[model samples]
Target chain A: MESNQNENKLYILFFLVLSVILLFLSSQMSWLRNYISYVYTNTSHDQVVNGRQVKNYFTLFSEIIEIKNENEKLRDENSTLKSQLDTISFLIEENTQLKKSERFLAKKSKYSEVNMFMGEGLEIGYIDLGSDNGVKKGGVVQYGQYYVGFIDSLDRSSGTVKLPYNRSSFIQVSVIKPTNIEGLNTDQLKRLVSEKTKSKAVAIGKGDWVSVENISTDKGVADGDFVITNDPKIGSYLVLGRIKDLDRDPASSSITSSIEISVNYYDLNRYIIEIQ
Target chain B: MSEVIITIFGIFLMPILSPFFYGFLGINVTALFSLLVLRYSHNLWVYITIFILSLLNDVTFHLLFGSTFISIYVSYIFDIIIKRVIPNETRTLDLIFTTISFFLFYVSLEIFMNLSSGSGFRAFENFQELASSLLYSFIMSSVLLLISMFRTYFSGGTGHKIIKL
Candidate 1:
């Protein structure tokens, strides 16, 4: 019995030593680590890992058909709006004087539209762009005029966009408190924040919704304010969501007293990745 | 065969549940695997499996090298000793041991990570985050233990051998 106990101890010692060696080797070897991550991501079907339902090809095909119909309707509306906009461009440009500004004239970032929805989670989707297309790891993704997601991971052929609703997705954002106007236009709001005080806060993803945290209650952040990304790489004050409510009291004496706000994003299919 | 299946299941399940316990920083659910191995598997295979799973977790989550591996291995050894001392491991004993071992795993791993991180390690800044994460983890572990106890009672003590064999 004593001999058996001694052997067990020896076995444990050997395993422990082996594990330490493996750990050291793994840390040093980037290829080994990358391969493991690649395999894990590949094997991990989207919605399955995130507890979202996996849709069959038939359901997907039907959804595609529905989207196609909606696209045509939007296309007709866009064309009609474009003709009307052309007639009023001179008047609008004269009023805002934004057309003269280089910042206003230049596009903030290049976009890669949604190619496919990959994986189990609705938030984790795939785009057609790759490293060759300059799609980077931290590149911001957008849906229409709103900030939605960022590039989670990517390879040579494809990339993953972690939507605003993902649990680990954290983005720095600043709330827009309209001072002089009831509802300011995007251009006006951008110029205002850029010219004046732009205090940034962090927003964390929570599945279907988002929550802004670490915001000092003393910042005078109120309800119905708009949240926009502070990512310089994106270089645009694209609205992310509206602040539905506040968590902390502005009257609280505690220095650690911080407020949280709810965030909502557009549906997954409308997302576009900003590539450089 | 059964052990391999269970270990694989655990590796897949732990990461999914971990983000829920996450506070300012992520909660250390790799400790849960260590706890599971301690409670079950009298042999060395479970420990070995846990080591591999912990390695996979560290790599996937971009944790520091040997941080989680060493912390969990130490916790496994700690649990072994605790099991011996508290021979009749009741629900209360299980909760107590889990809190002790979980905190042990967290502190040891965090220290190791901080040490490895060099200038990036902010001890005072991270203290609140770690504390909040620890509290959340404790609550989650308590709920899990309660569920296990309930399952054992409902199954007519068949599940009671979770700590023994």
Candidate 2:
């Protein structure tokens, strides 16, 4: 009975000792935590495997169904193509006539010998095709029929084209009125332009938007009047935004009108830089 | 001749295999296999093997340098802890310990890499990627343990005798 009691005590002591060691080892060895994470991950992976197999089976079945639908679509397309083949020669003749008319119209207009590679956005990197490619610094870059920006710096292979949307960029623009308005004098217009320059108009804050400031109500500058860059070297009148707001300057009694300029980056994305 | 060939193979193959397996299936099979191998042969040779295999893994995988170094070293620390603490050397206990060790190794590696790269604690931001990594580590370690058991059974030897705590 005494030996049995001693054995029981020894077993309890052994358990306590083992527990202490395990706790100490776990505290010191940081990898034990990682091992727990590993097990957890393994169990999760197994769960996912089971889940994904079911999902994949359904996805594959759906894909087969889609293929059948696509096959029917192709059959319809094939029959339509066959039907169109008879009219192909007649369409080709008409297409050639259209091409001739387009060419005639293109020949009559002035075409600039410039090519541009547009960037994805305002922050995109610029590459210059160089002066050898008729690209130079200070050259204007135009998107489909509107001025976007100009070349700021040039390299042998590429140039840095600065977008007009940059805050630092400033260009002189001409404010032209419709031919129907003849009563507005040039002095009145000059005063209007001067007042516009002085007023703190939000419209002219960035290159993306500009405002023509302080025109008199009598000068008759309508919403549709073209405001264009005054650079004769550019050789083309670019359409700036329509006048959105007309307001008189309260601080200046002489300032009577303001025209807000709109510049859209979307329209400017297609422009090629014209090398100066 | 065989020993020399195996040593060279381990040196060259571990790194290439680690990332390839990790990337393809999210498991570092080679690292786990190396750990199991090292379990039997706890000596200078084993440490050397671990170091070389880890170096190979680091170089071939384009992972940050010193990552494998730190991971294997930490794994060695865990091996010591397991040996010192677990008196019974039961397979279940070994598995549990190894899993925990593997997780800690991954966490340490991320911390070490972040410190070395100076990236601001961005590791946890990609929880899915981290989860996949942990899953791969567990799979690799489990397979390695199973293979070690199979190896012992087939050889009619207990493999490396577990050192008593």
Candidates 1 onward: DockQ, in order? 0.09, 0.02
The best candidate in terms of lDDT: 1
Q: Measured with DockQ on alpha carbons, how good is candidate 2?
A: 0.02
Q: Which pairs of residues collide in model 1?
A: A46-A119, A46-A120, A46-A121, A47-A119, A47-A120, A47-A121, A48-A120
Cα miss at B10, model 2 (Å)? 0.0
Superposed model 2: Cα runs more than 4 Å off: A1-276, B1-5, B43-46, B60-64, B120-123, B158-165
TM-score of chain A of 1: 0.49
TM-score of each: 0.40, 0.35
| Most accurate candidate by TM-score | 1
Residue-wise C-alpha lDDT for candidate 2, range B47-81, written one tens digit per residue: 45565555344434334444565665467568768
Task: For each of the candidates, give the backbone clash count.
Answer: 7, 20
Tens-place lDDT digits, model 2, residues A39-106: 34454344446555656776898899999999999999998998798467545654553343232222
TM-score of chain A of each: 0.49, 0.43
